[model samples]
Target: MEKKRSFPKFLSITLIILVVVGAFIGWKAYQTFIGPSVTDKEEFFYVHTNDTYDLVLARLKSQGIVKHPDLFDFAAKKMDYPNSVKAGRYKLIPGMSNRRLIGNLRGGYQEAVKFRFANVRLKESFAALLGNSFEADSTKFNDILNNEAVAEQYGFTTDNFFSMFVPNTYDIYWNTSPDKIVARFHNEYKKFWTDERKQKAQAVNLTPIEVSTLASIVKGEALHVDEMPKIAGLYLNRLRKGMLLQADPTVIFANNDFTIRRVLNRHLTIDNPYNTYRYKGLPPGPIMMPSIASIDAVLNPTDHDYIYMCAEADFSGYHAFAVTVAEHQVNARKFQKALDERNIKK
Candidate 1:
């Protein structure tokens, strides 16, 4: 046939060509999948949009979420995502591809943090909550609470900043600014006091601010929701009769330290406007943040003739209502006896 065909030469040339093509394809595929595919070991990641690329890269490296930050940067740039990046706190998970991550970042998806304000003391507790979300200056927040101009602009008297903040669960972005957080509380408070509430405030011959202050008192005194209306009635009766409300919570609030576990006669003498025992009427302002239930109680008090109340000796989270000071003294004595027996002086 053909002069003893050089079979080895033909075979060698064919093998060389096949090897080159295979290597080229393998390299291309590696480049495409290596950065995007989820590795077997990765679990979760936290991405911060506010961070610089270098900072993000550093965080990713520290968290072991990525092997190379440069890879992410290059991919994001290629996909035109760097310019469209949105700021937020994100949670990254396993099996997320580069394309998906880019989409999440660009769409501004964020994880929400739920903050609850139920049963909170106004000054100290609210400050702590604000600090959790922002690097808030507690002094500044307190100053604003006491600022006459700021209070007036927000339809509150400078003396009653606590009344303007109602307690509720708020869903906030992780990095929300302190001012914005405070503004949201103010807005929620405003929403709760609709036109109907305004009429009720006028009907009671109380300003919205006054109503809130009374609600704060109710919130502090009533241990249970069922007792709210009765407590509200007692205070309203006192207001109508021009008697001292003489609420113990007011004395506690006036102390400001919040550490006075017991409202002794000595504690009542502390010179502060919030001491209803010393002052004849409502304090200069609200003592604590009121719940909507408390607000409603103040707006719609029970029609009872009760003018006094004392915690039951049972400490059952219910109050003993009375129409006379003598009756209240009997209840008080019973409660004090219980406190003595249980060593619960506070």
Candidate 2:
């Protein structure tokens, strides 16, 4: 009788201990799964290329993003997340559970970065500017951008590849591959040149690339956005007459001297195809990345008979347009006198 009573007592004590241990384990698990694991402050965390599991943990701890690094570590290990780390920019919210965090990482569910750029001029400059949106080094981007074979595959050459980029904003992922970015741009270009726009180009008797080249010249000449169409018309008039476009912007582009505020006869004699005074047709490439406004101005050029434009004598940003040689000479003389008064000799 005594042994049986003692055995019952021992069994009760063992059950109590087991319950306590189970409760503790359950609590820990609940904490790991349902408890807040990330601080409510930071918005994002960067998982760099090839960042090891240990490094990510360290980063989390160092950035103070993780409220319980030890618990997260345990959860990550249990989920087998170390070997499949995804490189990207990820958004984080405050009071997030480790379960969600680890699951998101495992799923590679990073959001795309908001990328915006414009007014890119040179190929090298564009490569460097665009490289900031991705993980790869800019030099690799530059090489790819300059590769003639690659550009030609996209209906462009390295010489005219600058025309490929339409100046506008974009949204891109941080780890987006270079080729995909190029493809996206090409798609955007195709979408931009709608059937109606293509018809307009046909009416102007210029190819898309030719229009871009002319638009670049027009963009360089005028400051007022309203004047772009008129400038386009003036250049078109010159083109239709088989006369030289004689664009000062083209001369500046040929000389590769952006500091020349005024074009001189010396700059025109650079013996380069970019100089419209020397070359009867469009330059082989765009002088700079033309703006959408400029491109549209070309396709929808105002129909006019004006063939000459000279800076106004009043130092206004506007230009004095003329339809006759005598009228152009008068405008030119007035502008020259103004320039002499300002002592702005090239």
Q: Give the TM-score of candidate 1.
A: 0.82
Give lDDT per model, in order.
Answer: 0.75, 0.87
- List, residue by residue over 1-346, the lDDT tens digit for candidate 1: 5686556987899999999989987765454434454343544344443656566556656666644455566666777765675666665666566656666666767666677776667666667666655444566666666677877877777677777777777787756665676688789887978999999888877888898889889989888988897898889999989999999889888887677655788887888888899789788877777788988888888889998888877878899989887988999899888888887665
**Every model's TM-score:** 0.82, 0.86
Candidate 2, poorest ten consecutive residues by summed lDDT: 1-10
lDDT per residue as tens, model 2, 52-124: 9999999999999888899999999999889889988888988889999988887888878776666666788
Per-prediction CA RMSD (Å): 3.9, 3.8
Displacement of residue 138 (Cα, Å) in model 1 is 5.6
Q: Candidate 1: deviation at residue 275, Å?
A: 0.4
